[model samples]
Target: MNKILVVDNNPVIRKMLSSALEKEKYQVECAEDGLSAFDCLDRFVPDIIFLDLIMPNINGEQFCQMISGRKGLEHTKIVVISGVAVEAGGECEMKGVHASIAKGPQFVSHVIDIARKFTCDHFHHAGIYQVFGAENLFPREISKELLAANRHLKVVLNNMSEGIVELAVDHRIIFANPAAAQLAGMAQEKLLASDFAQFFSGNDQIRVIDLLKQNKIMAQQITDNDPVMFNHQQVAINFLPVHDRENSTVVVIIKDISKTKIAEERLRETKEYLHSIFNSVQAGIIVIDVETNIIIDANLRALELYGIAKPDMLTHDCRDLLCPRPEERSCPVLQEGKTTHLTTQTVKKRNGQTMHILKTATVCMINNRQYIIESFLDITEQKKLENKLHSLSITDELTGLLNRRGFMMMAKKQLRIADRNPGKLFLLFADVDNLKWVNDTYGHDIGDMLLVKVAKLLASFRRSDIIARLGGDEFAVLLSDSSPTGGEEKISARFESLLYEENEKKDLGFPIEVSFGVVAYDNYKPCEIDELIVKADKLMYSSKKSKKI
Candidate 1:
């Protein structure tokens, strides 16, 4: 019969181990700690010593070392029995230790198997050591708790997504979970028979070997981008090194990061496509982080528009780029919770030149983060063209003065201001005298020349004055604020002096004359521009009749 000495701090565990060993018809003795076991060993030498790592006096490590050095006990086998066997596998595998069994549901059975292996005939019975009537063997309460804990632990390990593997000191896999078997593309038996490091290839194998040789816990064995592969799947490896030199082992944890890696790769590809579109599109594009309101990215067109480099533009506040005034810094879409915004606005460039653009801002989500995409279409030239077209619409083609439509528009505005502010506003209307006779006598060219000359004389008024040719040899002027008091005398004298100078030039064959009407607007009562024109016209015809008399 094999003589086995069970040593542990827990009385129940020691009793349990001894009871199971004795059930196999072996001579078994129990000790509460390493000290008691050694005292028992002084007279009774066990063929195999079941040891516990943590004890009150003389721990298992010291007992193993002392027994390993002691004479007449060279052939005795040492088996470590401890709750921390998996965590301290290398520590438990001392010089004398033949095996290490974790204190679990299988612990008592492992003790029986080791005892039978050393003492019984080889190949006697290789199966789980089933203690018949286990209820009778252990106290009912403790037995239920232990069985429940073991069953729970087994369930958790078997169902875990991370591959759990425990290796022997010789690099043989001693245990493997279903996840490990799945990751290795093999059965649990095949995984147990194979070397764990053989699953890795090239530098990955080198990294695993280094982790084992270092004998330290490493959270990750390789870089994130370049993870270890098994069965054509990306996996991250974690190593928990056993601390004992004689019983050195490694526990590997394999996690499937294939989904995470694939997601990252897809994100990268999407960014590449966005980058391509950003530069290729004619519009300037900028990406902003909604949380920070910062410009996180800018395309080539945006960089060119800003006259800045991409690196310089990045990390700048979006408001700094888009808004020149502090009051305009608030984003309409972001602050108002709107989906998008569009506007025709002006932005200043690095060169301090103002640029007109049709800008669009949109809220977008990318990879679960909120962002604003601002697109700018340069409309500076387009704006210039629009203004030029507008000018042509309301401008007199012949005299470069406000046309009839433009005159009415501006005159109405000034009348409203004068009405509210109670200011002096002068309206002057003039008709070319003898213009028809000049056209009939000296030809229409000279008559046109005379009309142009009169238009020039009217322009001599202050720029604030509104001047217009109201069709045919007729012209009108709106003289405001800048006109001195007694404006009618000033107007008559100014035109008389201009006419005298033009007739003296002798380029014109005929003398230039004009009948003028000056009317003071009623500031208390506003009137339409056409009404003002009618009053001014009646006065002008009266002046013409007095001139004829």
Candidate 2:
């Protein structure tokens, strides 16, 4: 096995070169810097030294200069490796080195050829081997070891993810790897010996060829974020200028960056989608620093909420805006650093007018900093609508009285309040006499008028009383207070007086008569509202039966 030395500052590049050389059964040693390579040189005399031009401590030019004056190592060959084009034509032009190969796609094959020239027995300068037919690039034997080694080189190029192509000094691609053919979306044979300019699309071909014409290194453009397209496929390309002291072989590396470009586009699109949603939302969203409690970012709705734009909003303290009444107000969400959802609060606007708002806030960690994501909705109009809906849900539309549901809800609440004071709660169930007969003879309009009249009579019954129309021709009344106990008698007397007054004012076909039933709630011994209602209903039915007889 031939002993090869690889000296490069980059560990990854050194490892890659060492692995390729070792695969060809060469004993490879590596050094990180020029100083380290010098130390390795004193101990191990390699057959071919693949020297890097630019490195820390002692560079390739310095290393070559130092070694030229020394003795006994005259048989050892130096193949200078220059990553830059200038270094190959300038530094690697030193008389001591046998050849110079640029660091690029053809790097591995160059190392193998150089190693074979010094070690292999059946190497002919002409019949030895030819790569791209540009110059002598391979060493060969008639059979066996050389044939397998040649196959191994082909396999390595075939398996590489990046496309590697050997171009002549005219920029015509003489050799194309399987990866290069795949990237170009064509067969390898179809691309071989084709002009390199034809593979690239758009203005990239001009810029690329111009740089190549100038014999410049593509390393600077390779490190750039922008990539070019080849055969409609996105590709990052690099050119390596390989000088053999006589002629130059320019190798092109094409790396497919389509997936990476697509990912970047998707991420940008996702960011735009999120931004649209944030601004379009009805809720005013504001992001504030948790430590300083200052407004950092806000959406359009948030700006509208405060009547201010960005820089102005940034000046305002978020806590001060929310808790303007410092003496009387404090935010629990801010203090506790926890989520508060749909909390109803009255906020004073910039104009000093108070508006009701439903605010929600949560603590969030953004970029390793604590922030509060606060969202709020102006619910002043909503509150007004909600109160109206609440009233409609409970009260009857026609008579302006509590419906059955409304009566029960308030009755329950009032009963609880009265129970605390331990006052007697009286329930009165009232029904109009001959209401069915009135509807049958006088029609519904007259029947409705009669119902309304009775409802008006009971409208001013008592302040503490909860009065409601339980159903058709039936009503419920709850009276519970500390002051008076003759509530039932008062209702009876008022009903009779209204009945007489109506009869006197108009000549009616029949008289309006009302029947009443009363029950007293035992607060000391509590019971449900249903029991009191059932008891009152039974009493009302009994009174009706007595009057009928």
- What's the lDDT for residue 9 in model 2? 77
Assess each prediction's global lDDT (C-alpha) against the native. Answer: 0.77, 0.75
> What are the per-residue Cα lDDT tens digits for candidate 2 across 1-549?
678889887888898889988988989999975556766877887877888876644467656765674565676777777655232244346757767776656776877776777676333333322222124333323333544564588799889999998776667665678899888778665564468888776688887778687654443245337778788877787788777654466778888888988998999999899999999999999988877878888889887876777688885677678753556445567567555544778887777777788888877788999887889999989988999999999988778789999999999998787778855678888898899899999998898888887787676667667989888999888886464667566656665776678767664566777787888888787788889999988988998899989
- List, residue by residue over 309-393, the lDDT tens digit for candidate 1: 9889999987877864647867766776777888888989989999999988899999999999899999999999999888877
lDDT of 2 at 537: 88
Q: How accurate is candidate 1 locally (lDDT)?
A: 0.77
Q: Which residue pairs collide in model 2, if any? A: none
Report the C-alpha displacement of residue 152, candidate 1, in angstroms: 6.6
In model 2, the Cα lDDT at residue 279 comes to 96
Please give the lDDT score at residue 396 for candidate 1.
82
